[model samples]
Target: MTPHRLGIVGLGVISAAYLETLAACSTLVVTAIADLDPDRAAAVARTLPAAHPMTVAELLASDDVDTVLNLTTPAAHVEIALGAINRGKPVYGEKPLAVTLSEGRSILAAATQAGVRVGSAPDTVLGTGIQTARAAIDDGLIGRPVAASAVMVTAGHELWHPHPDFYYREGGGPLFDMGPYYITALVHLLGPIRSVTGASSRPQDHRVIRTGPRAGESIPVSVDTHVTGVLEHVNGALSTITMSFDSTATVASPIEVHGTEGTLVVGDPNTFDGPTSLRRVNDVGFHLLDPLAGYVDGARGIGLLDQIRAPRRGIARANGELALHVLDVMESLQRAASQGRRVETSTDADRPDPVPLTPRSEWLAVQH
Candidate 1:
């Protein structure tokens, strides 16, 4: 099969991670890159195998690019995606799809108008981490799932990131920011949500940075700093979600799903190699598993490290592909919520439902 050619629209930190993922995605290739900052584009260009750096316009016009990897910040997502779709290229976009639900709608409408496929973010759901867990539940290892919960708390990103202003603005907050990962995982495991009710606040006066040169800079808040919501799924499963940029405290047990037979402790949905643990109410031991199944040698690294090592993980060669699927679901959920209707999603229309696997850490081709 010919590899899907991709053109990336941004050279930010997130795009760097996407570039790294291509090492293991034998089916995808980065052929072009564009950024308003020529230097940033040049830097990203140097990292690719044969990438040609150009303006977004030039890249969009290139017939060599079959898909757009819209990694631009949330603010530019709508414009770039619209451009690509108008030209009949498929898209796999970064999270939130756009800075506003309105913007997301426009992008989706454009994709629909142009008859192009659109994929959205927080692809961690498709990673072996979440997929493996889904398989287990389907296989009856955890019996029938009844409830689940997820947490995402932080001190905010104004200090460490080079440009932190966008995060504190509207369209950027705990719910929209980290919400996709939690929501995407829940939908993947329990199916689409029917509704969500929530509370929000921008109560923090200031936040501290944990890393980088401006690590101690204080960031003022404009958007909601804390958010809690209930996802009422169609399958009668419910998910409790809590997110905040108000604290420096860490959260344990990123996700937990309770079922008739046992409980599953899931890894963070933000990355793919999360460990899954199952134990019945009266069980003596926790059964540990990696959602990636036969993929990966069972190493659990948290945060951006998963992105860094995904291309090299034993069975995570498919991490980038999984991310594409995850991006699709996250985009659909936002569109569903914004459009006041549930989305019917099927990019890979013929894909099979996941089959559960017994707990094991079988390794696959690590590299090469």
Candidate 2:
């Protein structure tokens, strides 16, 4: 098989993780890389013997590139993706798809017209952790899932991220930044969301950066920092979610699903493997479940891999439809919070097919 030639846009902190994963995969090859700061791109290119630094425009137009890996920031997602799609190259991007649902729709529409595919991140669901939990639910281990609760809390990204101003910006709140993981996992396990009721708060106007060269710097907060919502799934299951940058600690499980017969403590959706546990009716304690589905020890770039292996983008597990649906859920939740009313979602997605457990060697191997 011919390897998919990859042209990466944006060489930020998150790009480092993707590069590390790409180094181990065989299905794709990094032929070119680009960043707003050409020096940064060049620095990264030096580490990959075959990849060369180029301007963003040059990377988009390169004949050698079959795909564009968009690791740009939230605000730049749509613009970069449109550039790649217009050039007839398939594009995959980091989470939120775009800052707004309308922008995400535009990106998808443009890709459709250009005859190119689009994929989005938070592929962690493809990892064994959540996938195992999904397998359990599908196997009826939980026996009719009724409700779930997801919690994610921290002091704030400013505490450790070198440049976290974006975390508090319009598209960077706790919900938009972190909700995708929890919400996506929920959708995978239960089904698409039909509506949402939300409440939100921003405790401070500014935050002080506490790490790296930007330590002690103050950044303004323009979006809600603590967001709580209830997702009413189409399957009639309910999911309560709390994503906060205001709290320093919590003893709550990252996620838990309660059903008619049992309850499951789902592992972190941000990870690839799990120590997933379950407690049946009258059980004394939660018992660990073995890895049963998804890529073993998966990493950040698996969604792109799924896209590359697909015969058509629509069938890819992390296709644009799922990302667009996720974006719509988040935007509706935020609007519900701001308007003091429950909001109905305008989009929905069929649960992507479950992944059979893939051996570590196969998942990491480049198809030749």
Q: Top model by lDDT, which number?
A: 2
TM-score, predicted candidate 1 vs. hidden true structure: 0.78
- lDDT (C-alpha) at residue 303 in model 2: 86
- Residue-wise lDDT of candidate 2 within 1-368, one digit each (tens)? 77778999998889989988999876678999999999999999999877999999999999999999999999999999999999999999999899999999999999999988899988999999899999999999989999999999888998889999888997898899999999999988998999999999999999999999999998899999999999999999999999999989789999999999999998888887856899999899999998989998899898888888777434888889999999999999999999999899999799998988998777776442
For residues 10-30, write the lDDT of model 1, one tens digit per residue: 777776566655654555567
lDDT of 2: 0.91
Count of clashing residue pairs in every prediction: 8, 3
- Residue 335 Cα positional deviation in candidate 2, in Å, after optimal superposition: 0.7
- For TM-score, the strongest prediction is 2
Candidate models: Cα lDDT each: 0.65, 0.91
Q: Model 2 residue 248 lDDT?
A: 98
Clashing pairs in 1: 120-327, 120-328, 121-327, 128-291, 128-292, 132-291, 135-356, 296-315
> Which residue pairs in candidate 2 collide?
1-368, 26-366, 27-366
